[model samples]
Target: MSPYKGNRKINIPISIFVVVFAFILLVIPTSGNTEQLITLDKQKLPHKFSIAAPEIRPLVYIDKQGNIAGQFITMFEHFSEQTGIKVDIKVMPWGRAVQQAKSGNSDAIMPALYTNERAAFFAYPSEPLVIFSGSVVLQHRQDTRKIDSWHDIHDSQIVKVRSMNLGENVGRLFVNNRNELVEVVRIVDGLQMLQHKRVDYVVMDALIASSLIEELKLQDEIKVIVHPEESRLSNSYLAFSTSFAAQFDVEKIMALINQYNDPDKYIKQLEIYSH
Candidate 1:
């Protein structure tokens, strides 16, 4: 034992110091690498985005508690949650809403039906948010004339909401004649005119017509006429203003919308709000 101890008494303190130095070397780089990884992950997230939507009912409207609420609103909220985008909806008249979006005062307008004129100012998504069918709403009476197509009702006194771009041909038909194609301020006004026999028919979205008829308790007074031969399906979409489209990733936004735009999901949202 004495002979072995002659090899310079091993420094216990030096051994402990060496072990600690090796541990520090290993842990220091690991800690630095972990911090760098966290920073890189944070950089991968997308920036927040905001949008503007009109005050249209069923699609977009103010709830009883004065909150922006509707089927589209629910969809937009879900979109925000998925993409980390912040959507701020402003409820205003459709005309003003369009103007705001066009002037870049707002980032976007939702539920916009496609038209060549609107395309100049906004970028539309390839997939539509909802597909709406147009119908001719008329008073329920025994002597009501049958309407098979737009040509059949062309000469009749037909009323529609003003400034509504139904389509190029339809818009021309309505605006070209002021008397035969009466432009009302509201859907209710058009319905009232039909009820009073002031107008032969009121051209409106079938979904809105049904909802309005039920809400107004005019089930017995008003009826929706379907024209199978006429193509009346309109696709509504979330359109971004030209300026906003230039700055943001429009394709990415559209991709998210198309991914989650489910009819069953909308139905569930409508049912929840109905209750």
Candidate 2:
């Protein structure tokens, strides 16, 4: 009787072990098959994509010291490091660049302002790494008074570069009277226009305007007006191709941007490249 009881106990444990082992074996193969499907999906993405940047001053495409001047290089380098993707930077005219990105000739744009219309053309990461502030600057005219708000700009004839979008958020506020906004091709021309009293104001990015003013020695003529800050017209970002959403990883791109935003690290990194 004791021998029989011991045999029964051993058989029960052996049966449980066999059942558990079989279940694990079944699960392992199923898990591996699911993983393979995921791998296959990743492999189906397009191998390469292109990107473009609007000809924004000091930010996207700028020619400084006979060199392509802008933060676009820095932003692209960061993107490449994180995604291991190659991007062809085509420094075309602003209008052409937008057309290229819109038509899917390129995979993305380096830095772009947000707009409802633009949103339809490209994909954007939920977060923006770079923040931009713009202002209307011009030659310090003799009859200047306290310029305060967008309402103040209504009557003024402003000069902005052709094919440039201020952004949907601020566009409505600044673009009430299209006649007042003169479109110029070159910043030099715009500055010259301002100096010549051809335009009452030039809506320009603060940094680009400052850099150009210093580079061109236009401080004597142009001055930054201290009006009520157009806080609404603030911030733009790096945009990606919506079509390549599967091919590119958004998290990695965001991580790269976060690294750029780190003052302690990115500044040093920029200096290394700058020098």
What C-alpha lDDT values do all the predictions have? 0.65, 0.59
TM-score of each: 0.67, 0.64
Q: Taking the tens digit of each residue's C-alpha lDDT, what string does model 2 give over 175-239?
A: 64643667776666787877788777776665567666776776666666533453333455667
Candidate number achieving the greatest lDDT relative to the actual structure: 1
Q: What is the lDDT for 237 in model 2?
A: 60
Q: Note the residue pairs that clash in candidate 1.
A: none
Q: What does the lDDT read for residue 162 in candidate 2?
A: 66
Model 1: number of clashes?
0
Over 1-275, each residue of candidate 1 has an lDDT whose tens digit, in order, gives 56664457555778889899999987777765566556534643224545566555566777669888777778778877765556788877678878989998988887788888889999986777777654444544533576544555555687877635565445544565632777775567787888887777777666666666777777767665554532356677778888878876676667666676763333211111110
